[model samples]
Target: MRAIILSGAGRYADPWHPYAETSARLAELVAAAGYDVEVRDDVDAALAALRDDVDLVVVNAGDPDGPVPDGVEADAQVEVDDTALAAAMDRGIGVLAMHASASSLRDYPAFDHAIGARWEPEVSWHPPFGEARVHLVGTHAVCEGLDDFTVEDERYANLRLLEVIEPIAEHEEGGVRHPLVWAREFGRSRLVYDALGHDARSYDSAGHRALLARALEWLSHVPAPTADDRRGAAGPTSAT
Candidate 1:
């Protein structure tokens, strides 16, 4: 299988995150999952490159609408068309969104729905980065048979969910359990959003690696059902 990783750069780059380093780690993980991986720093270009042969698109990017810090020259505003990406998903491409990617690509209005979630600024925030225990919350092939595990990373708290998603993992903060991982289907596309991977350390966890590997394995073969195909079930399936 083939995978294209959209690594953050230019206007999508942020001061707080090490996008390049973490994207390199993600490339290694994706490659180990049996995919021929290519990493691209340009978000729009990568999306434009989406084709029938690309099985997966890993979004490891920063928010384009976010605040820009000092010393970083913002890239000129470039025209972005979501037509290619939307068409690709309509054709059953799998999406693996990581961390702050929940907030990336805001220029594409449907980007949040495509990933099944969004990071609402001010409303959504995280505490200091530290060791966190992630708990499995539901039954899904991506997380099946996996136990809760700890990792050194940022816990994305209170992200706004945009779709009916099955949350498969969570973490507690101040007695409130917040979802850290979820899986859902958008049209014919299968999507998984993981709110971990703040840095390379987060990817260093054996458990985290295992979870991501399972995600890749599932993404490589599964075709999520469209809305019409989900109507008569007991409840919405994870892929619906």
Candidate 2:
């Protein structure tokens, strides 16, 4: 198995801070899952390399609007090409959309549709740090071994959820319930989005890590890790 990580934009721009560290740590965890994981900080390069051999694609949200960097451009066609590749890969592959990734491709309809939601300005984080209770609502393999649990970190609001979705987690705040994690199928492809991973702590949380790992495994159809796989499992280290 092989996974490609795109970690070079939106809130992830660099001095190699927490976001970068979290991405690296996530890649390491993917590697530990018995897959050859390749991480590219350049969105264009990452997209270009998405042909075959890559079993999964992980896209990190990057800078909101500071130019598309060296490899990536502001071209919609490029975005469409990338989305098409991802969708094709999804026939039997996996795609993980992290934190701001939901908010990353506003201009690309294919990407927005594939993700099952488009980020709106109204969508913002609730409290920089707090314990959010997430309720599981899906029966997919990704939710296997996962129960309703709480994570200490940021929560998102005002997401425009598309019609196609199998919600896996929900959160109620101020008496309003919202979907926190969900899975959707797009033309034979499996797409999972978690509105968490906003910080290092959230990514490293045991519950969150397990959910992420399971999501990847489910999308790739890899056998769920058994007790033996967990024996020497190394959780992500601090990216600070």
Candidate 3:
């Protein structure tokens, strides 16, 4: 399977401030999962490159702080190129959203369609920094190999999850419930969204890694190859 990771959104203004490292780590994880992965910061180029070779697109639409780049309009919380992204999704490519990505495509219909949910800031503020246990609520492939787990990090609250969801992880804080990870099918592809990965520790969390691995495997429609497939083949290194 081939994958493309779109990161470094902050680079249009400050190259050093780009989250390229985080995105690179994500690409490494995907590559280690036995897929060819490429990382790019240019949104247009990323979309253009997805014309045929890409099977999955992992967009880390970073924080919406810097000014929108040339030829890209900032509409609500979504960038103008989001329409093109929707066009790509419409073509049946698997899409995955990470961290603050839920807030990136705020009012775009295609983004909503691709994400399978809409996020509202009023309802989705988790403690700025804390620990929350994630409860698995389904048996979908995205939740495969993972059970209930806990991670200490920022807990997001007040997210309006899509109606069609096989929740893999639910966050409970102060007796209130919120979704942390979930999977849903869109068109002919699978889409998974996880509200984790706000910090380095969250990304490094074992449970979160497992969830992401399973999600990638599910989205690519490629089962994990057996040990024998690794013999004389360029297999992915262990990510665990």
Q: Estimate the TM-score of every prediction.
A: 0.91, 0.77, 0.76
Model 3 misses residue 67 by how many Å? 7.7
Best by lDDT: 1
Give candidate 1 regions above 4 Å deviation.
69-71, 225-240
lDDT of 2 at 193: 88
Tens-place lDDT digits, model 1, residues 117-232 = 78998899998999999998877998887988999999999888777888889999999999999887766778889999999999989989999988888877645666676685
Question: Model 3: per-residue lDDT, tens digit, 122-210?
Answer: 67566767666788876776766678777766666777766677777888777877777778766555678877776567766788778
The model with the greater lDDT, 2 or 3, is: 2
lDDT at 191, model 3: 75
Off by over 4 Å in 2: 10-17, 66-91, 123-125, 222-240
Worst 10 residues of 2 by lDDT: 9-18
Off by over 4 Å in 3: 11-18, 63-84, 106-108, 222-240
Poorest 10 consecutive residues by lDDT, candidate 3: 10-19
